[model samples]
Target: MNLKGKTILITGGASGIGLESAKQFLALGANVIITGRNKEKLDQAKKLYPQLTAIQNDVSNPDDALKLYHIAESLGGIDILYNNAGVSNPTNNLAKANDKITEMAAYEMDINYISVVRLNNLFLKMLQNRPEAAIINTTSILSYVPSNLAPTYSATKAALRFYTASLRNHLEVAKSNIKVFELLPPLVATEMAKGIDAKTITPETLVKALLDGIQKNKFTIRVGDTKVVYFLSRFFPKTAYKLINPVKNSIKLSA
Candidate 1:
């Protein structure tokens, strides 16, 4: 719960939300380690924050995931695991996909869904042994309402949302101190949301909301417009779907 002195590991810490989180956590007196696929980016982050421990590990790779776990263990184990590594590839038709589209979709699943599960399972015991610990999964508003622009991304996040909910329930039943928090962010100004022309929040704003949510003991933290999206999807599924993918909805309506 307390950020001070906590050892936190953030996947995809090279840039975007993960990087911002690492920066804030370090400022809060936490020992932060960030994992990424880019060595240059990792080096750059280390330069910015000399206190940070940057590990070049791609979560999508099983070998890399194991390596990350061992590395974290060697760092005296982490108090928090931020499952923040993910990808989004815009695809018009999920089913009618070319090899490239299919590959991209598969890669999205591997990074977004599979990696989260692997890292959590690998680190669950270590977290449980700690006095206080947390697992933060960076899901998206598209977890509930489908995003036409990124069908695979939406589906994987939806899967993660469910899994995270289940994990929370399991931890509660087991009376474990390890907390599971789902961070659902709306369209944010990040590389992942590059082509998406919508009302987007900055990474700093999202990180502030995230820390606030964590402090309040909120398990499901929806930032900015994501809360509205979650509300609409909860009560008005069709309208939420239409709002997120107006063109497809209009085509369906016309048919």
Candidate 2:
């Protein structure tokens, strides 16, 4: 759980929450390596944080994932693999007959859920060998209550939520030194959340809570509205559903 002197590899680290996490992790005296699909953004991130090791990688690509592992290995391997890359297609899935619905859903699933599993499987052995290591998976508040406007995205996060929990339990049962941490964040004020009229928390605030949770050995790190939604979703499922999909935000499906 101790981040100091540890090497952490964060996916989608060019901007938003990932970039903020890299900045904060560096401040904690940890070696931070970031990967993203955009080469320009990666360069910019490197320019901003000279200490960051930014690499161009698409988490959805299996080849890139393998290449990333080799690159990390060359850099002495990573103690923390932060699966922070995710995509949300805000198009209402049931609104109309869209030919690309399956494609969009698949894309979100690959990056948000499948890629996490891939990265975990790739680095699990390395993490187990370390004295202290962790895998951080970023799920959303939508995992607790589905969002009608972003149904596919919600489903992906929900799937990731279950996967993270199962992985954590599996590791514990096997007496593995690798720690699995699930970060459930509410609507964050990032480029991804733009145009979504909802109360949001800054990336700095969310990552701060995440780091605090990791240090405290809290496996499930829920931030801001996520905590309230978690509680409500358990006892007041209807209210939780309403909160996530208000009347104004509900979609009307075509007949």
What is the lDDT of every predicted structure here?
0.89, 0.93
lDDT by residue (tens digit), candidate 1, 8-46:
999999899989999888888999999999999999999
Error of 1 at 28 (Å): 1.2
TM-score of each: 0.94, 0.97
Query: What's the TM for model 2?
Result: 0.97
What is the RMSD of candidate 2? 1.4
Which residue window of length 10 is worst by lDDT in model 2?
246-255
Highest lDDT model number: 2
Across residues 1-255, which tens digit of lDDT does each residue of candidate 2 receive? 789999999999999999999999999999999999999999999999999999999988999999999999999999999999999886665757788899889999999999999999999998999999999999999999998888999999999999999999999999999899999999999999998888999999999999999999999999999999999999999999999888767533322
Off by over 4 Å in 2: 251-255
